[model samples]
Target: MDRKSVVNQILSLLVSAAILAAGTFVFLTLIRKPEQEASANPKPKPPVVRTVPVLEHDGRLDIVVDGIVTPYREIEVAAEVAGKVVYKNEACNGGRFVTKGTLLIRIDPRDYELQAKRLTSQLEQAGANLNELDVEVKNTEELIKLAKDQLDIERKEVNRLAGLIQERIVTDSAMDKAKQAELTSRNSLVRLQNELQLMKTRKTRLRSAKELVATDLELAELSVARTEITAAVDGVVVQDLAEQDSYVQKGSPLFTLEDTSAVEVKCRLRMEELHWLWRQAGSQRSAQAVAADYQIPQTPVTVTYELTGQDGVRYEWQGVLSRYDGLGLDEVTRTVPCRVVVPDPRAVNLVGADAIARPSGAPPALVRGMFVSIQLHIDQPDPLFLVPEPAVQPGKAVWVVRDGVLALVKPLTLIELIERQTEAGDLESHWLVESKTSALTPGDRVVVPPFGVLSAGMAVEEDGTP
Candidate 1:
């Protein structure tokens, strides 16, 4: 094989010329292909950053509060009178119920009965006196008629005497004597008439002594009635003060009754809670706790109670939203006094359990009387906005890439903060949000890490394409 020539010196030069031409043609063709393609379809400039498609997501919150079950109605029984223990029913406590007019305890009836008997005798005496007055009135009526007749006779004699003396038919002395006698007799008749009238009037009325006795008798009977202690209302007898046949003093204690009317809830909403919660959803009367104002199944009320546990299941009792108790004194704490009725404790507990939490995810149970942190929505939608709250300060800035560059757009404020006593974030800790103007802008070339050179105008390559 000759390196430079082939067949002969002339043949070799010709062969070389042909081979060089062929190589040169192939090389030019390959070079022309890239230039032609480059002009036909130009590759785009890379973007400064990559972005994602945003979709609207729901953003409501569920709020949770700490609370406990409480009774809508409860009472403390106190005695109106004092008495020795005598007839105390064995079953008497907070849980017992009784019927109206039921006898709770009996005091000694001997003394009361004797007093009643004495009153009865006195009442009979009063009746006898009344009868005697009736007889006296009848006799006085007859006497009145007699006195009228005598007065008429005396007037006739005086008239006759006056006429005779004026006509000079009778002596002066005789006329004067007749006049004096008539006047004396007329005066006596008038006195008798007054006496008869007085008797008639007195007969219609009972004597003061008789009236006094009658009142005493009635009182005695009333005292006797009190001896048999009876339940005033339909309730449970919670306290028993006297035993059967026990001696008791007037106005002494005998027994106590508890009105177990119906079940209700007593919720103790703190003063601060009223402003934050829907306490006005139900009225005091419509609320379950108000006994007279509401019915058990039909009515509802705000009730409250205390939670006496730290980490255990707490028991709930009922209470009411009673009137505020501020008597001529300053309050150390400004919490408003609120009462909740515990009409149906089970229902109340269920509602309370749900009403407390405004959680974005699985939340812990709210304990009663404990303070909770909350995030509240303050402002509404606006034309201009900044970065969303949670992603703003912690993460790097995100922007839309354009023409191999970055276009920074306005951001949305995502989270609304309610600064409470137990809130997680502090005002001073939010330095990034405050100094956002100096750090970012509307259009700037940005570099997103983890994805190399995701430049503007770069093809949106199929994800996971190697």
Candidate 2:
């Protein structure tokens, strides 16, 4: 009975195992069919990328740099003549504006006037002495002439006496006396000639003395005028060291006037920025001229100061690239220091998106110590294509998409990297590159961000491409 029962149980187990194996085989076949179909019709997806159109740039590059405002001219007014300040104009106070030639201070002119009067008296005395010498010289010349005539007459008389003696009409003693008189008259004429020479020498001394007195008088008069200190330019007094009743010595500082008519912006430029500027200047000037001077071109620039707490509101003033501030690059910054001069510091334009929305008032003047942004409007020598900064890879290459394929442009002639403020007041950077390379065109699409394993001639699909 046990054997029969064991045989039946084994048969049932075998049947169950066969059924389970069949079900497993069926499940494998179903999965394998779909896998083989997929392997036979393979569809590889291409890498997706973002693209931006390469736009043609206007032949102008704006190099924006940070700068600080400075006065075009700072004049330290010093006392030319030492005296007590008897009067000081109200405009001579600190922070006051003064027009050119405005009286700023008056040193005690009474002492200068007295000194001038003494010099004048000395000059008059010298003039009188010269006149007297002239009169004396004239008298001496007349006396010499009269003495010569007398000598001639005495000689004639001696000759007449000699002739009478020869004719027995006169004695030998009378002839001798006439000869002696002629000798005496000759001595008198020689004395008068010596006196005339002495008078001429005296006149020369008197003339020299007169000239010296005249010079002294001129200097004295100048000192008198200098006692009244006047403003040398239309400027604002930033310092006032001299006050009424204060005594000042020669060369003492009285005030400091900053020229308000114009202002200078002190800025620094990198080597690349200077290269573009120099290249543009070289095109307009002769090679010889450039070599001789080698100066920075006076390119027009806009000096802008963003208003605090005012979104997108900037005060802009027109200026020119005046000159290099120093002879070489700055030691700490390794940049060339330059200056931009605004002819009118008060002439300001409210610029920006929110400029029109802001309240109207007097725009602040471009004074010293104001941090500003200077935009140098430089004209490029050639046309360039603008590409987004992210599109430019390291080593100056850009990925261009054409016909659903990616092409790598290597060794692009990058002119500059510029930043512009968008309408949303956000700054975006772009690369300005020369279009002469032929790798990039105005209408070409450039791959931007979210880059994958990029290779030349790789199949790529634009994100928005159909």
Candidate 3:
């Protein structure tokens, strides 16, 4: 009975197996057509990618920076002499512009004038005294001459008396009297000479006193002149500290003046920017400059002030890269501070295509505390390639398409990344890079974004290429 049951099961299993094989054959036949058709065309189309052509940049590169306007010179006007302010000129007020030597204030000069007059009187008295001494000296000289003549006569008399005494022709008393008269005349001549010497000494002292008085008078007059304060430079008054009837001591602050002759712009630049500047200065550097370590060149810069409420309307002033502002990089910004000096702040040029004619009232001069834009014009000594920032992959590499194949270039030297304004007034960031080992030329196509997975030596087609 088991054998018969097993045989029936085996036959049933065989029939089921045959049915499964038939179904499998039918499935294979239906799928083989599509598989064979796909095998017929084995190579799939290459992926399309967006690419940008590298452009050679002009050697000139303009670096833009924000700056502040400052006065070239700020002068603190102070009182040179102490006095009460008797008059204050209208030009002494704040915001008033005054020319050099323009009198701005007047102090009470009466006191100084009185002092001068007193000195003058003393000087005149001294002169009069000197004249009197001169007259006395002359008179004494004349008297001395007369006394000499008298002495000579006395001597002759004495000689005659002596001879008489010796000859016994005259009494001894007459000879004695003659001797006494001769001695008296000699003493009188000596006295006159002594008086003349004393007069000469007095004259010398009087002359010195006269000179001292004259010097005093000069100083007094100088003080009087100093009482009237005047502008030492052509500038605008920034502050007014002196007023009418205000008493001020010497060295007191009277006003503050900002020289309008020129203005300076204070700006900061990154180290990368400074490198370009150094390159520009390298060729033209003098030995003296090198010795002095004058690193920043006197590069020409354009200072622009955008007029408020006026889009694209800017006032431009030509300036030079005068000096470095500080000794080192700024502590917070890590940038070098520099200064640009505009020799003539008033010489402003309107620099917009739609700029209107200069109005009757002149544009505002570059003053202190004005925020401005400074563009440094620098010329690079070497050629550079500019590529869109996105084209530069990680590790300073770029995906360059050569002969319709993707090639990944690595280790490209990135000189700088700069934001430039397009003609449409849109800002676009570009990478200034140089290829040292790779054959990256000016017209080489660099693959950009919006592409599929990329691999080295993979076939790719430029999206815009036919």
Q: Candidate 1: what lDDT?
A: 0.47
By summed lDDT, the worst window of 10 consecutive residues in model 1 runs over: 375-384
Which has the higher lDDT value, candidate number 2 or candidate number 3? 2
TM-score of 1: 0.50
lDDT: worst 10-residue window of model 3: 286-295
Off by over 4 Å in 1: 1-86, 93-95, 161-181, 197-208, 237-246, 263-266, 270-272, 276-334, 343-466
By lDDT, who's the top model here? 2
Ranking by TM-score: 2, 3, 1
lDDT sort, best first: 2, 3, 1
The alpha-carbon deviation from the true structure for residue 187 of candidate 1, after best TM-score superposition, in angstroms, is: 3.0
TM-score of 2: 0.85
**Every model's TM-score:** 0.50, 0.85, 0.74
Query: Residues 1-466, candidate 2, lDDT per residue (tens digit)?
Result: 6999999999999999999999999999998998899889978888989888888886588888999998999999899999999999999999999999999899998887998899899989988988988898899889888998999899899878877898899988888889999999999999988888898888889899889888988888999999999998999999999889989999999999999999999999999899888878877887466443646778999999876678767888999998988688889989999999999998888887667743565356889999999999998777888888998889998899899998888888886788866668788888888787657777899898888788988998898722
Please give, for residues 214-312, the per-residue lDDT of candidate 1 as tens digits.
788787677666655666666656566555556566666555665544332222334334432332333323545544322121212333222333232
List CA RMSD, all candidates.
13.2, 5.0, 6.5
Q: Each candidate: what lDDT? A: 0.47, 0.87, 0.87
